[model samples]
Target chain A: MSHTVRDKAKLLARVRRMKGQMEAVERSLEAEAPCGDVLQLLASIRGALAGLTGEVIEGHLHEHVVHAENDAERDKAAAELADVLRTYIR
Target chain B: MSHTVRDKAKLLARVRRMKGQMEAVERSLEAEAPCGDVLQLLASIRGALAGLTGEVIEGHLHEHVVHAENDAERDKAAAELADVLRTYIR
Candidate 1:
């Protein structure tokens, strides 16, 4: 998306941070950390993933749902949104 | 937690799967996939993380909140739950 290209740097930053978080989770497992500690780390990763998801979704909604110029484009956007939501909610 | 020991294998499996999903996200970025594809990958990761979080949270509630031995124990559990919820929400 055009919007995505503009946000690519920020998005990639988020991706890298998430990668670090994932590795932390793996390290915790390998070290046999306490369950409470592991749960907290997983929760942090979950929060980061949610933030990233929200960023992309906000962009999608702004570009498609809110700004579609034609009826067909709007329909396509709505359909894609539904599809994404279906997967997201799972 | 005692409950965690019982479920360690299952929990580790979830962690590993989430790690794989995350690597897919990085791969998609490296391949210059469409924004839509990247977003789909993110959504899937979110779903998996949520699943794993739910599993751990369930165990925590069952072991601590539900089966707490005394008021003091229950209160501690509640406080920890609150801390985790706050972090998860952010």
Candidate 2:
């Protein structure tokens, strides 16, 4: 199994927390919270997602890229990662 | 300004590296690099994107979430962040 799958339980916990956060956002909106308040919440949610993404990415790198046995393999991994990064960031 | 905008140059530089990495992936595919090699490359690319996402997230948290002056604001920020995190990880 992929490293992410191996760590599914931990990841799922994080996901659950994220869900709770979203629910809070809904609650705030329903209550007609200030725009600044809502915006702050949104920004936090985005950050959490980013953190989760980073963790998964780090696992993949350790399992597939950094640990690769050959130079060609490592180089290839780096290239593929770079391409995806471009699309993701944009 | 959002911290990301202020640090655009550094972010862009990283983006450029990601582009270069993608180019390498394309070249490898064209040259018939082994399947294992290609998979490794893809994994790396994903990781790199994750890294970039993390950076942006950190910036947002620092500027908008952590720096908020009130407890209510902080809670809202955290909640919103959690929600987005759920969507992102899935």
Candidate 3:
């Protein structure tokens, strides 16, 4: 968490760009752009999501999984990461 | 494209929800919410994106691939879809 806080600005920026991409998708649909155009927008949105997600996962790995004070803490962090991955990578 | 046009409202609705979810992500960071909470939000966003992407892909399959007037049209559609998928499934 502390680690993520350290990188909060950068991560938030990624999220904001992604948000903007979503707005573009909305606009494209409203304008009834071609399906190819919408698909291109979706590709970018997904890329942004993957970028943000990767950063978060990396921070967790460094903070809780690798740098945890004890085995119990490490296991908990790993489990939580695994659980999130289950939901995320779907 | 006509297939997507028919489903425009529904697809736009999905994009709007995803946009709202992205805003929540922004708020969570601005409030400095815990990483766990942010990860949960990311999971939901990814799910919503996958759902929308699936629908679009299906529509393309019906319009450009399965229902194409000729082999040339089907090939072009498949190629475009493949290109999008290459970027998307990253």
Model 2 stretches with alpha carbons more than 4 Å out: A68-80, A87-90, B1-90
lDDT of 1 by residue, B1-90 (tens): 456667767776777887788888777766666557777788788888878877878877888788988888778877777788887554
| Model 2 per-residue lDDT tens digits across residues B1-90 | 655556656655554565555555455545545434444554564565567656756765776588977888678767766665675666
TM-score result, candidate 2: 0.44
TM-score for each model: 0.78, 0.44, 0.88
Lowest-sum lDDT 10-residue window in model 2 chain A: A29-38
True contacts preserved, each candidate?
0.47, 0.00, 0.67
Q: At residue B27, what lDDT does model 2 achieve?
A: 56
Q: How close to the true structure is residue B8 of candidate 1, measured as C-alpha lDDT?
A: 67
Model 1 TM-score is: 0.78
DockQ of each: 0.48, 0.05, 0.72
Judged by TM-score, which candidate is best?
A: 3
Best-matching candidate per lDDT: 3
What C-alpha lDDT values do all the predictions have? 0.76, 0.59, 0.85
lDDT of 1 by residue, A8-48 (tens): 77877788898888788777766666556767888788778
lDDT tens string, model 3, A51-71?
A: 888888888888888999899
